[model samples]
Target: MLTPIPLLIIPLAIYNIIAFLTPGVAWTSGLAEIAMMSGVRWTLTVSDVFLALCLFVLLFEVMKATRISSRSIVDHILSLLLFVCALIEFLMVPQAGTSPFALLVAIMLLDVIIGFSVSIRVAQRDVALTAAPDQ
Candidate 1:
């Protein structure tokens, strides 16, 4: 029973790590190359990174609003749906010059780590919430 908060944060943390290791400039270059090969002329600017960060924050807010509980069947289904969609997107997207196998492995690893972390966090939160106050 992974919680959503940790589920989201772990991936963001991994992204931050990757970003730090590669830096924005190099990332942009790689993105540009891929985009060019895909016939997508999108510019990989600082704004793109900013936009991603903003989206991540928005996702976190959504997760907070929809607090997960063990009884939330809908939440579980929705999470599964999201995972499926992400898998489809990763598989269908053009890899261009990038190594598809490596990208897939990384994406899968990220998904697993985030999912597990979130489940644990959610379970912990549920316990804390249900705990009775000390007199």
Candidate 2:
């Protein structure tokens, strides 16, 4: 039951909650600054952190795609739907117009593409193996 649900949706909901509930928050504002040994200061902003979280979720999404099952098909469908919804919001919604949100949408799209592609490839391999003659 839980397998059909897209994991990336969690980050999407979190982004929406942050955007709509706290309008004053800035994505570009630095969340942390780390100084390197070479005297370089690296600033990690809200946008960077959000995008990193999305990417982490994406890694899990790809891993989940490796399993061949009925639930995985449903998962791919839901992931595609999620990508469409996110794309729509990125294009038409003011709050979602930021670079971080745009990248999130792109990551969702990648998730859908990778999910479907991997499923098909794995399914093909399984079919081929099953059809092979006995030694």
Candidate 3:
């Protein structure tokens, strides 16, 4: 049920909401500044935060893909659809033309590829195990 829902959509939807609701918001604008030990300052921007969150969600998405079930198949299909939509948005929409959005699209694409590859590998292993000759 819930397992079929692609987790990557959360960051995509958040980006959409922020981009649409807040015009003139600079993705590169620093959200926080950390003083480094080398007497320098490291600035963390909105884009950095978004990318980090997407990666965290991706970890769970990959874990979910490893489960062999009908829900996982649906998840892979939905993830593929999500990647297509994100890629189209990145290409066609002005608001989605930022580097952060592009990275999100890339993450979604990775999720789809990983999901399918893992599913195929697991299915092959299962087939091999079940098709063993009688001793």
Q: What is the C-alpha lDDT of each candidate?
A: 0.46, 0.92, 0.93
Model 3 lDDT per residue over 97-116, tens place: 99899999999989999999
Which clashing pairs does model 2 show? none
Candidate 1 overall lDDT versus native: 0.46
Residue pairs in collision within model 3? none
* Full ranking by lDDT: 3, 2, 1
TM-score (all chains, Cα) for each model: 0.33, 0.92, 0.92
- Once model 2 is optimally superposed onto the true structure by TM-score, how far is the C-alpha of residue 9 displaced, in angstroms? 0.5
RMSD of each: 12.5, 3.1, 2.5
Q: lDDT score, residue 34, model 3? A: 99
Q: Which of candidates 1 and 2 is the stronger one according to lDDT? A: 2
Best by lDDT: 3
Taking all chains together, the TM-score of candidate 3 against the true structure is 0.92
Model 3 misplaced regions, further than 4 Å: 129-135
Q: What would the per-residue lDDT of candidate 2 be over residues 1-135, giving only the tens digit for each residue?
A: 347799999999999999999999999899999999999999999999999999999999999999878889899999999999999999999999988998999999999999989998998877744467889
